[model samples]
Target: MNKQTRPLLTLDQLWQFSLQYYSAREIKEACLHLQNHFHGNVNLLLTLKWLDEAQLTFAPQDWSTLTHSLTHIDALLRDYRDLRRKLKAQVSDALYKETLHFELQLEKQQQTALVNCINTLELNPCETPQLVEQYCLQLGAERLARIFIQPVQAHYHTP
Candidate 1:
């Protein structure tokens, strides 16, 4: 389908897509690697995956707007994630699980904000690897980019 004919992506759809992929071990590892080593935004990376699935591509200005709009929330997520990691070993398993739940809520909030921003933007119709590559290169994480783009093994494909 062409750009005009393509359906707009919703928050629920994006969230479901994220949940499915994030549950995969390889995708989780790749996302965390990007986050830990390259300061990449997992929400955005997952959004990229969603967009690619939908055959949608963002324009340069759209990327700028989305990233700029998410900066504050992303900063909060980063801080909380760091704290969560630090507490993992120190806290009781139940407490750590609670922290993990809270972090997931924060991630959902970020995704909500992302969908709102996306609704106001103009998107193109094309293969999205170039866009993903551009984003990965900007993060200086070419190796992680390959992980994102490559197809996972069949067993790992199940969400």
Candidate 2:
């Protein structure tokens, strides 16, 4: 039998950490900027950074749920993104602005669902050495350029 792979933090655990860290206005701003402005995968970015915080190793297969990654919320995000773009031209419309705000709330709910989906897995604690590099590699060079905010360095690196 093939040995099944394990992940560092369960979806729920990862989400909990995300909520805690992102609760800070600055961190949340940075994550949102990377997600909105750059093409970086926000969930992966948040999860990867969280794993690094706990000093855990990166198990590639652990991300098997990657397929399920944004599937649940892709549509909502797409809609929100589209509306956000449209709102740029109609920024003065109160109704349009309110709609954007509603879409943003829906987007947040979708993210919450995404993080809650794979909550069963346990966090595999270890001394993760090159996880930051791995995350950077996954993010790719172009996206990383915008996503890699200065203070973000303190969060994603090995100790």
Candidate 3:
């Protein structure tokens, strides 16, 4: 069949072509299909598609929102970790402390928001949302780590 007369390509086929040619719109369309198929878990892939799509619009305000959201999520996770550590140290029983530690680890593994945000941002940094989100995640992690850890400073001595 001639190119113009050929049947419309399925999203999967379009995705393959897009990958080979770097066609942003085709990739974006395929990602939307994947997003629908996988629910919201594929936000990163979807974000990449969005960024690559020539038709997609990237506004500055959207960047601010995306960045703010990522920062907020990272801060929340860090705060939760701190709270867990504090509770662990305060506990008198060794068994309880161990249990708390295990629980905290489990809780952290269950955290998808931060992971998804990071993945999405990294997929397409040229876009406002992707760039801002990545920056926020990086900065927030550094700032939080530095601002906390008072106990470590007071108790630990480097030899």
Candidate 4:
């Protein structure tokens, strides 16, 4: 994989990278799998991938602070996600779609907070796999780490 060496310096760049990364069906499935099965935070996982692509390493203290700061937002995201999933079959299609749209907005908010947290810290260059592996280990989701680190399927293209 040809990883980007330059760090993403703004929230827009991180959000764009995330949108492109998440657009792949396989990538989306993998992320959802991790989220559902391993109790992973999708936005945090995506942020790790973004940082990995830039070859940036988050110090342990910084990682803790970042996660701490996102606690409230994460709780809200989980609540909305649960509500969305619960309403999927019980509600009208339009209502379900509205819930999904609101959930996506929360996701963007989480990403924005992630970018803001990282922007204040001093990060160092590191091997891409190491950074991702560390995060996976932290989440106890080492088995699914490869899905985030490996390149997406050949058929997927950036939009």
How does model 4 fare in lDDT?
A: 0.79
What is the RMSD of candidate 4?
5.4
Which one wins by lDDT: 2 or 4?
Answer: 4
Candidate 2 structure quality by residue, lDDT tens digits, 97-129:
787778756656655654454344444667644
Q: Deviation in angstroms for 56 in model 4?
A: 1.0
Residue-level lDDT tens digits of model 4 in 40-159: 888888887877777888777787877876897999889878888887889999988888888888988888888878877788898644666677788888777767777544427647
1 or 3, greater by TM-score? 1
- Winner of 3 and 4 under lDDT: 4
Which candidate leads the pack in TM-score? 1
* CA lDDT of each prediction against the hidden true structure: 0.80, 0.58, 0.38, 0.79
The lowest-lDDT stretch of 10 consecutive residues in candidate 2 is 141-150
Tell me the tens digit of each residue's lDDT in model 3 across 10-70: 3333334334433344434433443244322123332333344322334455555444444
Model 1 over residues 48-156: C-alpha lDDT tens digits?
A: 7777666778777677898887887988998999999988889999999999999989999999888878777787787544656677899999987787775334317
Q: Estimate each model's TM-score.
A: 0.86, 0.58, 0.26, 0.86
Error of 1 at 159 (Å): 14
Pull out the clashing pairs in model 4.
none
Task: Return the lDDT, model 1, position 42.
Answer: 90
Error of 2 at 66 (Å): 3.3
Arranged by lDDT, best first: 1, 4, 2, 3
Q: How many collisions per candidate? A: 0, 2, 0, 0
